[model samples]
Structure formats: structure tokens, C-alpha cells
Target: MADKKIWQELCSMVHPGHVFQDEPLGKYTFTKTGGKADFLVFPESFEEVQKTVQYAVANDIPYTILGNGSNLIIKDGGIRGIVLILTKLTKISLQGSEITAQSGAAIIDVSRYALKAKLTGLEFACGIPGSVGGALYMNAGAYGGEIKDVLSRAVVLTKTGQLKHLEKEDLYFHYRKSSIAENGEIVLEGVFSLEPGDVQKIKARMDELTFLRESKQPLEYPSCGSVFKRPPGYFAGKLIQDSGLQGTQIGGVQVSTKHAGFMVNVGGGTATDYMNLIKHVQKTVKQKFGVDLETEVKIIGEDLKKQES
Candidate 1:
């Protein structure tokens, strides 16, 4: 937990009501299975984010940047220091064929917005559940289109709380990877350069992708979405399915029978259950096929055992 003096100073930086102490992180995550956050601040504007970050840096406090918590798992003991959740900073605008979205805005919503504006290129993101910030962080893609294909530039805050505008070439995007972390930059907004197209055509494509996603993904359960990255020449889900690991359960978490790629929290699942199940799947799959499955989901925080000790 943050010291009382530090907590008071943080609360003064933003809306006091937005500064939560010992906040339960599970309530914010898609998996609904994490622990608490020592300090969680929901900044409503870019300026607020800058101020909070500057305050943390000046005080020598560690801080973590959190998006919408869609593809993440927080551990049982929770995070120390401060966590800044950017969901409240959502805003989107359109100028000519270009669409600019604040980092916290949902990617799915941005895609729909693009379609509504008769834009063509963003149709592939119509069903993605992560925020624009999260998407840019991982260069998120689906159905053969990716952020790198349409992204013109991004506005980010450096570790020193200074804002920088970076062109697409500076991003260095790859499959589920970007230079965001290595550069210690916090994404503020994304500017996508799109083109005018037939709305009906775009809608049809989005609808088709949505149907395929609903049919193939385990959307009915609370999960972290696709658990592992696709290995070269092999699909993670297919390999796990071929290994006969579907319906496997560790505590209340289960490898979904619907989609082998997902591990769902059927009921009272914990982060430990999720971690254990992931290790088991990797071990089983590697032993069976000699292919190493690397996780795509971001897992953080401390375990209960370490916290108690």
C-alpha cells in the first residue's frame, strides 16, 4: 500500500473519487479473477494522465499502465505502487478519411465508427475486444488486417511525462509485439488513415467476421481470450485440441471445450488456477508435439504465497 502522505498527494492530482486505495482489480479485468491494486487512478483526460505520471516519477514510485484489461491476468497478491487505468480517456473524431481515437476508446467501437463513416480498412477490427491503446501496444490484428496497415501515427507520453508524436515507421510492429514497452512510452491516442468505401460492403465483412468469432471462440465464458501465440506452421488451438486437452480443468478454470485456445473461469477461478493450467497445457503440448507454445496474454503481479510471506 502507498504511504498515507503519498496517497493524499495522489488524490490531490486528480478527482479524489477517482483515486481508489486497495481497489479490487478483478472487478476491472475481463477474466474477473485477480486481486487488489494498492492505488488505482482513472484519469479522465490526457493532461490528467501526464500530471499523475509526473507525480509518480517525481516521488520515485513505480507505476503500471493498464488499458481495458481485456487480454491480461493480474496475480493473487495484486500490484504494488500505482496503476493507471485509461478507460476514462475515451474520445474519437473523424476528419476527412482519417479517424483519430483516444487510446482508451475500444477498438471494436472504433471499427464500427469507421464503418459508420464509410471507411474500409478498419473492418477487420470490428470484433476485437481490446482498447485502442492495447491494440497499438501489441499491433493487434484479426482476419488478416493489423494496426500497422492503417495506423498513420500515435501520440504517446514518455517516462518523463513529455508527449511525442510517432509516425508508423517508428512503431516497429510485429506479430503481437511493438516497441511501446521497450521505449517506456504510454499511448495517448492513435490516428488511423483510412479511405472512403461502400458502407454495405464494410458491414458485410464485419458481420461475417463476428459470426466466425462467435462460433469459434469461447465467448460465453469469462476468459483472457486467445491464450497463446500461434507457433510457426501450427495453430495453438489445433495443437491443444489434437493433444486431447479440451475440457481440462485446474480448480475452477478450464480449457474451454468450445475453443482449446481459451481458458475460462467457470466459477470461482483464481489467477493461480489460470497460471497452473497454462503451464500444464504448455508442458502437455510440448511433450506431445515438440512445439513450444508461447503465451500471448500478459500476466503480472505477485502470488499469494509471496505476499503472505
Candidate 2:
């Protein structure tokens, strides 16, 4: 557990009703299998986020930035120190052909806003179930389009709590990885430059992508979108499928029969179940295909038994 005095100090920095103690993390994550957080703070504004982070740094309390929790797996022993959630910092604005959105804004909603504004470039992100910060954090892409294709610049909060504006080149985006991941900077907002396009055409593209996603993905169950990064010349799903690992279950978690890339929580899965299954798939795929698979999902927090031991 975090220090009570530090928790009190953090609570004073944010608005009333924003701080929670011993909060269950499963309620916030997509997999619904995490333990708890020592302290969870949902900041409503950028200033609140800055204040919280600054205080945590000055006080020497460990801190973490949590976006929509779509591509993360928290362990059963839970996270220590402060966990900041940016869901309430959702503010978006449109300036002519460009859209500026806060990090907490959902990428899907941003794509919809762009579509309504007749913007052409964000059509591929209409089905991505992550926030703007998370999308930018990993250079998220789909259907041949990526954040690197449209993002002009972003405002970031460094680990030292200083703000900086980073251009597209500074982002260093590539294949589900970004400089932000390496630098540990917190994305505050992004300005996406788009082009004027036919509204009907943009809508058509979004609809097509949405249909394709729904048809193929196991959206019915609880799981992170994709568990592994795409290998250089092979698709993660095809590799797992060809290995005959589809529908394989470890405890309550199963490799999706619909898409082998996904590990789904059927009913009562735990993080251990998911991790064990991921290792099993990696070992099997490496043995059969000689290609190593890397995880795209962010896994954090300690293990329950580790604390007990």
C-alpha cells in the first residue's frame, strides 16, 4: 500500500471524488483480470495531471500513466504507488483541416469527428479501441494507415514534469513502437493534420474497416486487441493458427478460435493464466516456425505469490 500521508497529499492536488484507494484494476482494464491499485487518481484537466505527476516525483512515490487500459495487463498482486487515469481529460477541438485532441480522447471518437469534418486520413482508426495517447504511444495503425501518417505534432510531459512539443520526426514511429515508449514521456495532446475529402468516401472507408474488424476479430469476448507484435514477414495470427494453437486454453483464458492472435478471458481468467498461455504460444511458434513472437501488450505490476513469498 502507498503511504497514507502521500495519498492525502495527492488527494488535495485533484478535485474531490477523483482519488481512490485500493481500487480494483480489473474494472478499468479490457481483460477484467487485474488485482488492485494502491491509489488511483482520475485527473479532469491537464493541470491536474501535471500537479499529480509533479507531486509524485517530488515526494518520490512511484507513478504510472494509464490511458484507456485497452492494451495492458496488470498482475494479480496489483500496482504500487499512484496510478493516474486520463479518461476525464477528454477535450477535442477542430481547426480547419486539423484536429487537436487531448490524450484521453478515444481514437475511435477522433476518427468519427474527422469523418464528420470530412477529413480523409483518420478513416483507418475508426475501429481502434484505444485512447489518443495510447495510439500515439505505440504508433497504432490498422488497414494500411497509422498515426505517423497523419500526426503533425504532440505536446508531451516529460518524466521530469516539463512540457515539450514534439514534431512528427521526433516521434520516431515504426511498427507498433515509438520514441515516447522509449523516453517514458506522457502525451498530453496531439494535433493531427488531415486533408479535405469527400464525406461519402470517408464514411464508406470507415464502414468497410469496421465491418472487416467485426467479421474477423473476437470482439464478443474480453481480451486485449492483439497480443503479439507482427513479425517481420509473418502475421502473428497466421503463425499461431498454423501452429494449431487456436482455441487452446490455459485455465480460463483461451487463444481465440476466431483470431489466434488474441488471448481471451472466457469467464474467470487471471493474469497468470494469460501470461502462461502467451509463453506457451511463443514456445510452440518458435519451435515450429523458428520465428520469435514479441508481445505488444504492456504487462505491469507485481505477482500475488511474490508478495506472499
Candidate 1 per-residue lDDT over residues 122-232, each given as its tens digit? 989988899999999988988999999999999999998999999999999989898886687999999999999999999999999999999999899899988999999
Tell me the tens digit of each residue's lDDT in model 2 across 5-114: 87778778897588999999999999998888889999998888889889888888889999999999999988988999999978999999999999999999999999
Instruction: Provide the global lDDT of candidate 1 against the true structure.
Output: 0.93
What are the runs in model 2 whose C-alpha is more than 4 Å off? none
Model 1 TM-score, all chains together? 0.98
lDDT value for candidate 2?
A: 0.93
In candidate 2, position 301 carries an lDDT of: 91
Clashes of each: 0, 0
Local distance difference test scores for all models? 0.93, 0.93
